[model samples]
Target: MCGIAAVLNLSLAPVPHLRPALGAMNRLLQHRGPDGEGTWVHPRGVAGFAHRRLSIIDLATGQQPMTDGRGNWITYNGEIYNYVELRAELGAQEFVTTSDTEVILRAYARWGADCLTHLRGMFAFALWDEDRQTLFCARDRFGIKPLYYTVVDRMLYVASEVKALLPFVPEVETDLEGFKDYLTFQFCLSGKTLFRGVGELPPGHVLLARNGGVETRRYWEVYYHPDFDHTAKYFEERIRALIQESVAVHQRSDVPVGAYVSGGLDSSIVAGLAAERQGPGFKGFTGKFSLDPAYDESAYARDLARSRGFELHEVDITADDFVGSIEKVIYHLDYPVAGPGSFPQFMVSQLASRHRKVLLGGQGGDEVFGGYARYLIAYFEQCIKAAIDGTMHSGNFIVTYESIIPNLGSLREYKPLLQEFWREGLFEDLDQRYFRLINRAGVLREEIKWEALGPYSPYATFQ
Candidate 1:
């Protein structure tokens, strides 16, 4: 991914200092794109856009903050994986560059904000519509890339990371409500961030700033419309086809691509499919801890690499390495995330960066497939409750007690979580029960200032 930053004078007048401040913001994200850097201040000095470019698709000319001769300019991060098809559909002869960035700009020029519907990729971008004098900004549908913005003195500062907005903000202060949300749910709900006054542009949403006013509206949403009519075999075939097609499209790149093979089902499947398309020279990276055999999974990665005829690189993570890099890692992450997984993931990413500019992994598999231990724990309690209440045949039940009996053994290892979740929410509604299952705030209640956090229920927000 590249990095993008913008400064918009909501007053609709000149802000001389903003042009230099935009350059400084892009410098903070230099690590994201060391290949190139560019900045542009609107002729009227009302806005400025900057880009840190990591050339991926078109290594020769994929520079940014690029513009169309008609006065539209864009500073974009992430790729449009289906750009080739989109370019063909948009009439390839009209474009000057092979870069996906141009495709996005032209798409917007033709379709306006409706252009978001035609794009199929991860992106967070800000485009200046010179004619309308509007700054149109959007984050991708899944939030794979980040876009943060905060309004200061009616001047809006937007960047790929919060650190870029530091110099301009009044002071670095904690957002108490966001902190409380993080304490309760390990993530902030809505567009909240730990930094006071800064808000993330939620995925599938667009932001338009003009004439001293900012407006945001959702452009897309993921609705669960279950297909009850389809047979199991039909779904299986569709899923397989979708996965193959997804991997094929993701493999589009001008540079060699690699995989992060974790020796697990999801990553293994991704690696296998990528290897099939990548052929003999594919590279795979894995990280394992040498402290215990149970902590290591590199052997499985080796086995897959051997069978798939791909080169495998391994890193043995140690306590010393963690100690050395923990501070840097936390600094880069801005705030703490879920767990210790980020540490190893960082190590493996460092290993991969040595050989490849792009690497694929199976990150969202667990969330999509309900593979997390908490899901099983919560569902196990549901099964027990259903059996006791004689709701085995309830129309709302997705899995009956009998169907889940064989998997009950998995709960044995999650006894602590089961205890915490069931202690208060037994026989409660699903939303309340699931809320209890994920809540991590009880242990820190004494340390929090309730008044500062305000009257908010994370559970209510979650629902």
Candidate 2:
């Protein structure tokens, strides 16, 4: 929703170039936070922080790089859904504005680092403590927002995007391990990023930079303990409640909000919910590719939008458009994330931006629910393996001639990798194997060049 950047001088040198570097970074992210920009120059012995605000909350007064009464400065880039509740709890504190940014500052002032536990929603923020001379930065629990940083020559540089930090760093190099992970898992998993020396602050973690040393630690994780006791009805009720709550929080924007509608169940569900909440004539946006039938899902989107009686804006993207936007997409991404989906996503975002400053997307639905087709394949594979083993209760199967036979045709390209999986004690567990089957691109190793494959091979360890 916004962009944040900070520089901590570990060399203890005067930072005359700090403002210039931040300005360049902010310029790159103007699309993200076009409303306003603010900078905080630490007095004498502290770090500098900058913020580009989109003004979603308390648009009139929620300007940043905001500081508390005690001079503890913070430049926040996120929406804290529970800020109003937190404000109520902090009864006696003299309030300056009705923004979540101030609530975050006050909460940090009272609870210190422990404040992260009580808050909810997506965010990445940098807080500078003048008294302690420490800098604390954190990313949210789900990674909905991004934060990339690098420690070069003992100087800690962080920003909402990697492009912002590029100007400040002397050189740019690829991180081979991260590239390999990207190839293996379409996404650069967790902390690994494509740029050498540049790393993403993993979700639900905090990083502290102090006295030329950096320490990173996790603060939260999603617990996967299966709830076997809950019935289908109970689970549905809980899911509905969570979805409504999440949607409500996401819709807390001062500007008019719109939805991106694809024909898929996830986007359709989001559009439906948004339309219901906002009343009739809600605006929806969709992107259609002219040459790619495999990529076209516009009809479904149009049908859904029509059924909901909402106005739909459709953009027909051609190959030329795709080629022209590739560099811009890569630049905005800060790292290469190879996926056909990103193209349409960017186009849709562009179209949505024309109508609304903020748009709600139906991402994360497939991951949360068992919506992907790969999950179904994994389930079928498990059943077949169980049947072949002739063990009624024992679902696990040992490596044998028939185990890989059925999957051979579809997984032919990954045969060597599959063989290696068995050889190296990988994919032995059912869940791990399932994840591998779902996440991997089943293309033959020879089809893609070694150079092309360089980025994704490291994740093969997990497969």
Alpha-carbon local distance difference test for all models: 0.89, 0.78
The TM-scores, one per candidate, come to: 0.97, 0.86
C-alpha lDDT of residue 97 in model 2: 90
Q: What range of 10 consecutive residues in model 2 has the weakest lDDT sum?
A: 395-404
Q: Best-fitting candidate, measured by lDDT? A: 1
lDDT of 1 by residue, 1-463 (tens): 7889999889988875976798799889998898999999888898999999888988887889999889999999999988999899889999989999999998998899999999999999999999999999999999999999999998999999998988899999988878889999898889999999999899999999987799888999988866778787999999999999999999999999899999998998899899989898899999999799988989999999998989999999999999999998998888879888999999999999999999989999999989888888777778888778877776655666666778878777878877777676577888888888888886676687777778877777799
- Cα misplacement distance, residue 309 of candidate 1 (Å): 0.9
Clashes of each: 0, 6
Please give the lDDT score at residue 13 for candidate 2: 62
Check candidate 1 and list the clashing pairs: none
What are the runs in model 1 whose C-alpha is more than 4 Å off?
394-397, 447-452
State in Å the error of residue 216, model 2: 0.6
Give the C-alpha lDDT of model 2. Answer: 0.78
Candidate 2 deviant stretches above 4 angstroms: 11-13, 290-295, 386-427, 430-463
